[model samples]
Target chain A: MGVIFLHTLNRMRGTMLGWGLSLAGVAILFMTFFEDIATQADTLKRLMQSYPPEVLALFGAIQDLSTPQGFLGMYFFSSMPLILGIFAVLAGSGLLLQDEEEGVLDLLLAHPIDRAQLFLGRLLGMMVVTAGILAIAFAGIALSTQWAGIDTAIVELAKSFITLYVQLFFLSAFSLMLSLLMPGRSTAAMTSGLLLFVAYFINSLSSEVESLRQAARFTPMHYYQGAQAIGEPLDWGSLLGLLGLGLVFLAVAWWRWRARDIRITGEGAWSWRGLLVRSRGSSA
Target chain B: MRSIEGNAKTLDDPMQIPAIEIKGLTKSYGRVQALRGVDLEVRQVEIFGFLGPNGAGKTTAIRCMLDLIRPDGGELRVLGMDPRRQSVEVRERTGYLPGELSLYPNLTARGMLRLLNSLRRHRADPATIESLAERLALDLDTPIKNLSKGNKQKAGLLQALMHRPELLILDEPTLGLDPLMQKEVLQILREARAAGTTVFFSSHNISEVEEVADRVGIIRKGRVVEVLEPESLWDRSLRRVRVRFRKAVDPQRVAEAPGVTLLDGSDGTSVVLQVTGEMGGLIRVLAQLPVRDLETERPTLEEIFLALYRNDEED
Candidate 1:
């Protein structure tokens, strides 16, 4: 477990560097708006003068971008979760699925570790690294706000960052589940991409599409985006729902992975037991 | 054809139980059968050679025994433990060099060894590993991606041997090595055996197996066709004799000689004989040939392996 976690952490170092740069860029952009809210507010109003409320709502759905708290919400809450959420999915899928693709899983499984321990160890490590990335982004946002002389509740801002990072936990689980179900890395990557895009579309279109509004309840993003624990009372119900979805996806992924016949370089022939098991169940 | 269970003297008789035992092991990918009722055994402390052509299920059997892949139907025990149920224990005592020597590309040779050492959770003396590396002429500071195939193989050998496990399971261990390095690996295996380590390895190289293996198992179409001691095998299989007569010899007379399967007779001066059972009868015939030159050759391991595979193909 320690070996797997260390390796996962090592892999995330590169991705974390990218996240740091992005957060730094966003923080610089937020710094530009700190000096004068009235002028910025006027510019935003003028910018939205010709656009419809739906379009402005897409742009302004979170909070007024005039105050530090609102600006933090716009910069960190509105963008970081989505950016880091995708990053988490891509990273998590590659972590375990690449072993299968490379066929190293065979050599690894020959060792003493159990399947459950390996899964949980890798998942925990990935979660820790992801949490670390979000924390760095949070630190970047806080410093930028303070340097700009903006007054905001640190506790409230911290809560919002936590909510955003928690969204990534759900995405990592969902992407990992997709990785185990697909046979090849390319197929797994495409499936994770489709899941992420579909989830995003579902969350965005929920308000516009009458039929999808209630259907969005099944999507994790709906709960994560709606949790909005900052600048408001914490929504325990949505938080619990997101947590439950994450656990369920992880369980399904574990079940799928336990039985996977990992081939190195994808060169080995198929196993008949897999066919027997599939025949006993659904085709999938 | 020998039942590992029926051979119960394994408990009391040191030679009765093989160090490695596999029975009725069957595996398939979709419609392709990788192994079908494959059974094999290796006596304790003996150098057992598994010889097979590509796609002949040698790797599959090894993987199953290592518990890397769960077999569909089989019972496997290595060093008296079920590999699937006790993989960690098996791995702890077994040194394995995979067919493909792939390590973390970003890690240097030393880093790769350190990582494996950490995973094995054993105290691998740096000095010992360094000496092995130096002896193999492998560079320790170079990243694995930058190393040539031979160097990568050397790195893998270091990882497998540094821990000094009791059993060495090497798959094509000499791949990418210079002839000298190949000889070095063979000597290392011999040294390990002398130290009481049971060595189970697979190879396509016939001479290497003939040089080291105490017993050889030939597999074809995922089944063991023959397992025999080299001396005994050479004794049983057919022999070749080339006789150049001083003058023209009678072909019919030579054909009537016992145990001589006539291969060819040209110009009445030279003759080839496939001696099936013994050289006793052929030697008797050659005494009367007034031979100018004579040579006798035994069937090589290569021929035996090819014959086994070709027979499988015919079947």
Candidate 2:
């Protein structure tokens, strides 16, 4: 665990700091306009109604513009998924592939650690870093809301933040598992990043395209559902589904990782266990 | 085979447990075979050299011992424990240095060592690390990126040696080092073996392997083709002999000489023969003629290595 976290943090601290600070910066930048927007809430709401439902859905359809939750839900929550999803994809692919690609995995593996333990350690380290970034975002938004003199429901805000985090957690894990199946780092990162964008688009356009509503169910972004957390109870079913999917992805990642041969120049031949596991109808 | 200079006990103890043992180990890539039934055994406290050219599966065999890569078929034991089933136990007792040493660019040498040391089942001694750093003339405070390639390699060596495990598996251990440092590293390996630490190191340089290895396992095309002592190879040294007869003698008589193979370009002026053993037969044949000047040249290590392969091919 120490080796995994130390090595992961050594490699990833800069990326984490950059993403976390910039995300919080973006959230803070959006919040500065909150006070000015609150004054023209009625007019802004009418303007939003004039746009197509697709645009409204993309922005997480706001019912009451005067409230802080509605204002944040419209801009911040709507766009945060894309930012968080991109970070997740990068982190997921980089964590597993960095050592091998950089020619460091063999040296690290020379230590007294098993494949399963190493996999768990790296996965946990990525999880902790992702959580830390979202925690900062949550704090930044909360402070910005308070400074803007809006009385948002604290419980609702916390629940929304938790739900948003869970969605990204699952998305990043699924991407990580997807990366395990890829041959190269850049290919994995690009593939997972493209998947994130596609999912975001499908989830957003589901409102306008009736046929896509069913399709959105498969997109990871569909489970975020943070826009409505303040008005009603949090979606436990969707949250559980996301959690379940995250576990499945992680398990698959482990299943494949346990048997994969790592190399410095490039990938090695597929292991016998990898083939055996695949033939037994496990993760590919 | 024990070293010519090794302690008598290692050679005397027929019941001694082998430090590493692999029987008919086999591994293959999708279409390209990487290892083809490799069989080798290195006894405790012996310095075993794994010699092969590039892409000859030396690194693959080392990786299998560490459980970093699984073998397709074989029974492999390190310290009498199965590498696949008791990997952690095997790893805890064995220290490995990869052929390509890559350290974290951001971490200081000390930081990297400390992190790696933290993973040891029996924690590595910090004093051991310091002593090694001092001996190697390495800066522990410098970030890995700031260190030169040779400096980084020194740090890599320090991490593997600091723990003082029962067995050390090093792949191309002296790569990317200056000649002076290379000699010092070999001395360190020799000292480790003298201290009863089993050292299993690999290299393509025949002289380096001959300098320190107790027994050498020659690998070619993913198989251990031969295992022999350096002294034996030295004894069988193929010599190129030149002879000039004062008077014209029968070329057939010199060409068909025992323990000698007449090389091309052997004309009346000078006859060149590749002699593998004692020069008694060649000397007797040359004595019969009016010999003027005689010359003998020994084959280089590389030539001898190639000769071994060439002999194997013919067989």
Candidate 3:
């Protein structure tokens, strides 16, 4: 288990650097713009009001657009799930299929480790990276708010970041589950990534169309942001639901992987839309 | 229908634990059956060669012994332990180099081996790793993705050989290696065998198997067809001898000779003979015939192996 975790962490070192820099970089960049926006708060507030109601959904229904946390939440936290979801899904999908595709899973499995250890070890590695990347984002926002002369509570912003981590964790767990069950890497990645996009899209659309209001409850994105958790309390119901479902998915992934015969290639390439779309018997 | 027998470890008992034992093993993926009733036993401290072409279930049979894949039916034991129920225990004493080898692309060869070592119950000695790296001439510091195909294979072999387990299971160990490197690897296997490691290796290269294997098992389409000592195989082997006569020779005369059977009617002045016994009598007989050109081609190990597969196909 230690080896699997270390090996997987080594593989994702470059990814952690890339995503960490970009996401945190974007957060800092947005905060730097906040000071300028705060001065012209009146003009920006009027402009935001002039836009359509659907456009306000972009800021996650934040009423006070003039404040620093409001601006950061609108720009950074709202789209956090979108970016982190894909990253987590890729990590989860890669936890198995990456080694499977490269044909190294056979080498790893030849050790005195159980199939459960393989899944758990790699999952632990991905989870650690997720936490580190999220911490970077959280730190970047907390400090940038200070440098920008904002009076927002650091603890409150940290709370919002926690929710963001939960959302990404759910996506990652679901993706790992799909990777175990699906026939190919791209199938798992694309399916989970596509689900994230559709869920986010539906959550946004639920704001306008009252029909999708209750329907949005079924989407993973629904539990992600508790209206940015700016001043309001954390939604414990959504939090538990996301955490619960993630564990369930991981459990299923383990059971399926432990019981099944793993094929290195072919038979699962034909994703709804993915790389190497071929039918069965293509492994030869 | 087979079940395992318990072994008693006592000084008086003198127990013999076979490295691997399989009885009526069967496995299938979906509708495609990869292994069908494979029954084999590899003795401890013995080198057993498994021969078959690609997709002939060599990999599947080896995996079952390691319990990497569950067999649909049959019983398997490795080192006197049931592989299915005690896979981790079975694997702890085995070293495996897969047919399709892959290492961590991001990590250097040294780092990859370190990771594998950390996970193992028995740690590979640093001296052993260094010596094996030197012997294989593998650069431990280089990232595996940057290495050439042969180099990567050498690295894979290093990881397998580094630990020096009791049982070494290699599938096409020399698959991507050059002839020179392949020879080096075969020498390593020989050395390992001398050190008392049981080698259960599968290869399509007949000569490689012929050179190192004490006994060879020929598997075709997931079934073990034949398991025999290499010496016995050579004893019954026939050599094709072509004798070109200076003058037209009587086909009946060559056919009537001892230890010689006419393959085909004398091709013009040349008689193609299949010789089974000592070449001395056949050569003396050919000498009596005004032989212009003489050539004898021994049946290659590959030809012998394929003959078994071909015979199965015909049936």
Best by lDDT: 2
By lDDT rank, best first, the candidates go 2, 3, 1
Backbone clash total for model 2 is 0
Tens digits of per-residue lDDT, candidate 3, B53-139, equal 777789989888887778999988888889878888777878899888888777799988988888785468887888888877899
lDDT, candidates in the order shown: 0.73, 0.80, 0.79
lDDT of 3 by residue, A1-284 (tens): 77778767877777887888788889889888887877787888788778887777755764555776578767777787887888998888888878778788888888889887888788898988888887877778778878877888988887887788888889999998998788777888999888888888778778877888987889887777633687778999899989999999998988888876655554223444333433433654
Order the candidates by DockQ, highest first. Answer: 2, 3, 1
- Cα lDDT of model 2 by residue, B121-227, tens digit: 44777767777788788999999999998899899888888877778899888888899889888988888887678999999877788899999998887899888
What local lDDT does model 3 show for residue B133?
87
Badly placed stretches (over 4 Å) of model 1 are A36-38, A52-62, A265-284, B1-17, B232-306, B309-314
lDDT of 3 at B89: 78
> Which parts of model 2 have CA positions greater than 4 angstroms off?
A49-57, A267-284, B1-15, B237-306, B311-315
A208-254: candidate 1 lDDT, tens digit per residue: 56787787777666766422565687667777777788899889998
| Model 1 lDDT tens row, B1-315 | 110011111234456656799888999876689899898888887888887777788887887777777788988898788987787878877778887656777889998788778767755678778878877889999998999999999998888877666677888889899999898888877877776677888887766887888888877778887787756654555667888888998876777777777788967898887776668877787787788998878666455556435666666
Model 1 residue A77 CA deviation (Å) reads: 2.3
Better of 2 and 3 by DockQ: 2
Once fitted onto the true fold, the runs of candidate 3 whose alpha carbons sit more than 4 angstroms away are A55-59, A265-284, B1-15, B236-284, B290-306, B309-311
- Can you tell me the CAPRI class of model 1? acceptable
